[model samples]
Target chain A: MTEAVLKVENLQTHFFTKAGVVKSVDDVSFEVGRGKIMGLVGESGSGKSVSGFSIMGLVDHPGRVVGGRILFHGRDLVGLPDEEMRKIRGRRIAMIFQDPMMTLNPVLRIDTQMIETIQAHEKVDRETARQRSRDALGQVGIPSPDERLMAYPHQFSGGMRQRVVIALALAVNPKLVIADEPTTALDVTIQAQILYQMQKLVAEQHMGLIWVTHDLSVVAGLADELCVMYAGRIVERGPVGRLIDAPIHPYTKGLIGSVPSRNPRGQPLTQIPGMAPTPIDLPAGCPFRPRCARASDICRTTPETAEHLPGRFARCFHPHLEDAA
Target chain B: MSVFILRRLMQSLVLLCVMTIIVFAGVYAIGNPIDILISPDATQAEYDRAVRALGLDLPLWQQYLVFLSKLVQGDLGKSFVFNEPALTLVFSRLPATLELAFAAMLLSIVIGIPLGLWAGLRPDSVAGRSIMAGSIFGFSLPNFWQGLMLIMVFSVFLQWLPAGGRGPTANFLGINSSLFTAEGWQHLLLPALNLALFKMSLVIRLTRAGVRETLLLDYVKFARAKGLSSRRVIFVHVFKNILIPLVTVIGLELGSVIAFAVVTETIFAWPGIGKLIIDSIFVLDRPVIVAYLIVIVLMFITINLIVDILYSVLDPRVRLADMKS
Candidate 1:
């Protein structure tokens, strides 16, 4: 892995609203290696999704990447011209949204959407693009691919629609895929099925996948490595097994503790004490300090993210590093 | 699909009956048309004979039955002023208005939607704000006033177009229409623009609002991430989604424009049905008036049916819902 599939270095995405500048993603950094499944774990407003958008150069107006180097297979994506950025999107990196129902244009047939995606990056004829679309559908395990291609988004059930969306993303054979909670809207069984298929796809294709989600459980089962975000920053990063078993950053600990399965069935679930700080009024130091029980006088400033142990990173003055032994 | 169409036609049939009843009652209450038709110095016998000949002497309900029965037999009555079949007169005038309505609609859709999309995409930009502000002027100005202003500017000042009247009409498929010739378009431009002003503003507002809301959706972000060019993203993804509302509004607007282009037609002295109806109303030409209204109702019914079909075409969800029921 001389060059990871995608590497985000010191990414800062800010929203300049009337209220003030909202640092939606502040000083976040991570990398997804070849065939690696990296979980970008965070609750709502934690910037996990924003980080994904930033990497794709899809940040809308009022919010922008002010600082960062999004090296996709070694080329810097930050401030890339629209033409160049578009060339990379879908061709080299694809994204899946939380809801499959909304992703495909409801008015268009499945073939039209997929064909358009293929033709957008490649100079293929309509029939060729359509064939690629059918192949993509088959790859995602869609039954009767030809018939499904002719169908519209609404014709597919929830899980089937998600599979179509995944097919759309994988159609281009991109080196990296950013999935923003693509399975969150499905039933448990369907979610598990999609996750398994996606994991299999990544391994077989040797392409990196960034799974952005708030569900630690889903990522715990899916991701090889994990980055825990709190208030627009990656507060901890490590292999999933070590990160979940011996979590460091306080927010990560609180998040892991709050999972319903982690707590005893008869007991009340662990709850984080405060709502996430609004990006506009983030504390001068650690944005999570107010909600952190481990906050001390020395934790009044931002701690640098660095490797505290081999291949382990955390931005905390007092990370639970006793497990490093 | 056939079942849906059958149900819609049944609904339209009931609506048509109700409309005819209301229109008949409303017109009957507008006072005696015979009074206006007869001269003040005409002999009593002459007046009675004239009334009897025109069938105005019949009771209102009896008159309606006569009218409805003749309608069922495909006779739409005769224009008292023109001494011709009411349906024939209307059909002759229809092409003028149809061409005008189509032109106006074309102008509104072609100009309105893209401007609205641009403004919505960059709400804070100078062009975006200016476009929004200009649409306020478009919708706020009175139709007659706008027609007068258009005539003043293009005809009076610029001398770029004709002041009033329909230009030379060429027969196309046995339908004499001025829209076939370039000189016809020059004569048409002012009146068409005037007729379209309000509708253009409405399309702009609705498109802007829809695009603004749809832009914030995860699907739009996903479309962008798929590396599609902004052109494809906005046109295919965003535009297709927003068109549901636009199609609904445009269908209703087209019907209204054709039915109510009275002010523009009058201002330009364009020989459309709007002008015909106005004159018919003044002379108390009951046959023509009734015929004109029926045509309008039919047009509205047809437009609405087309709208429903268009909805199914533009949004698969509508078609899916149709299937479920």
Candidate 2:
């Protein structure tokens, strides 16, 4: 197996708010190997984004990585000083946000932003940085890369802007990229294009990628592995194909079953009965128990992560068998 | 770009025309200037003669037409009291007022932005809270009262700076500046600081809010993930985003600073346009008053034009929108 570029162990990120402490990401763990993509699938407020933020050390005030180790290439990133982190961030571990505008400064030219991203880590001169920026834009399939570089974020369409942001992430040849719903806002056509470009880039560069999204459909074709989160914890994780074909956790089953394409046309769509529990005031034991159909008395006590099949893990009292379907 | 500017200039011209009419009508509606111009002991004949000489005897519409025609020819009429062309009197005082307004604006921006940026970064911190609390006081305090208080503290209590006046000035670039001399700066400092306090508070709050808002934006997070130094993230990515709103505020505030310096100038006995206007208002010096109003209206229009241009420069989105229109 390729070496893991990132290994997050028992990570816990909490927000200390006036109302209460929000356990946004509570004791979640995952690993991403070189040239592989890990899909972090969760609904909104499921802490998937927060987990990504914690690893990037970008969590703001009130929200902090309270526990866990973020191992980047075997080095613990948990308490790394900002100066050191600056050297490692963008240069080795880049992140793409849900909104391209979030990554693109509306006022700055695309070239300036991309070139500066390069110069920020490496001691490259303006000419070399500019050339690299142009190449990165071209790699992302932007036509007339030279002219596009001179344009600002606003000059490009939403899809093109996201492509620019993707280019910026890849500009420094990062070993790991954490993309938090980078293509969620785009239409299907643009989404496919960006996803294809991202997959191609990661494979070619042998870079590890963590693609966080709520849509399983998106991850199905893109990621090598899948981690399904409920509330703040990972419920099920396995190789993407196996997890989709036979989900062990009830929540995972519910999620996969609910996909519109999974059901026959003219049939009622499947949905989990209850709402996902709020993170701030969560019930003890399993978070998905309220919404889970197979929940039992054993679920009232927190389920331990148990390997049910080869290299597949699920936190559940009753794991689904491979032949259950 | 030139087309955009031309379009905006045309709009400004229309706005200026409308503003001049309102101001002309508004001033005339307040009361007759002839009441103050004519001495209490003067006979009816003397009053008639004075009214005729000042063209106050003409109908309001005719008076406006005559005034407009003269204005078109670069004639601002004569000051009833100063016995010189009203434009000359206003222009003579323009240097002093411009000096004060510029100094105050410079002081506000230089001190306010950094403090605001600091306070904004950690708004809940001890220093940030204190700065915010101070800003509230700055915002709430009356300019006249604040000017007096500053004089009492820095000039009377400390005796470190002068109490009032423009003090000694040195000529550079054909403009006399108090900043060139120690005594002039001392004299200028109290009023400039007084003038700046309210605006400084505004800038602080704006910057704090802007920083807070921009920090929450995804781009800032992406920048951090890119492993750019926190300084670069805050300064380059975050600062540029916040500056859009800041520029708008600064441009608008410049006009207000010039218009509202009356109180500070009065307290400090600074011989700026505000002081001149106040004096003109008291004695009903119609020509000077009218000229000052017209000039202020022109200044506002010009400032607004600059701001619009700056908006395009700072944000390419604005430029694109302009191009579309």
Question: Model 1: which docking level applies?
Answer: medium
Superposed on all Cα atoms, model 2 deviates from the true structure by an RMSD in Å of 2.6
lDDT of 1 by residue, B177-273 (tens): 8877889989999888988878888888999999999888867777777777778878888888898999989999899999988888888998889
Against the unseen true structure, what C-alpha lDDT does each candidate score?
A: 0.87, 0.88
Off by over 4 Å in 2: A322-325, B1-35, B38-48, B320-325
> Which pairs clash (backbone N, Cα, C closer than 3 Å) in model 1?
A89-B227
Native-contact recovery for every candidate?
0.89, 0.89
lDDT of 1 at B120: 92
Q: What is the C-alpha RMSD of each candidate to the true structure, in Å?
A: 2.7, 2.6
Stretches of candidate 1 above 4 Å error? A1-3, A265-271, B181-183, B320-325
Per-prediction TM-score, chain B alone: 0.95, 0.94
Least accurate 10 contiguous residues by lDDT in model 2 chain A: A316-325
How well docked is model 1, in DockQ terms?
Answer: 0.73
- Estimate, for each residue in B131-212, the C-alpha lDDT of model 2 and write its tens digit: 9999999999987787888888888999988898988889888767777888888888888899998899999999999999
Single out the weakest 10-residue window by summed lDDT for candidate 2 chain B.
B316-325
What's the lDDT of the predicted structure labeled candidate 1? 0.87
User: For model 2, what is the alpha-carbon lDDT of residue A104?
Assistant: 80
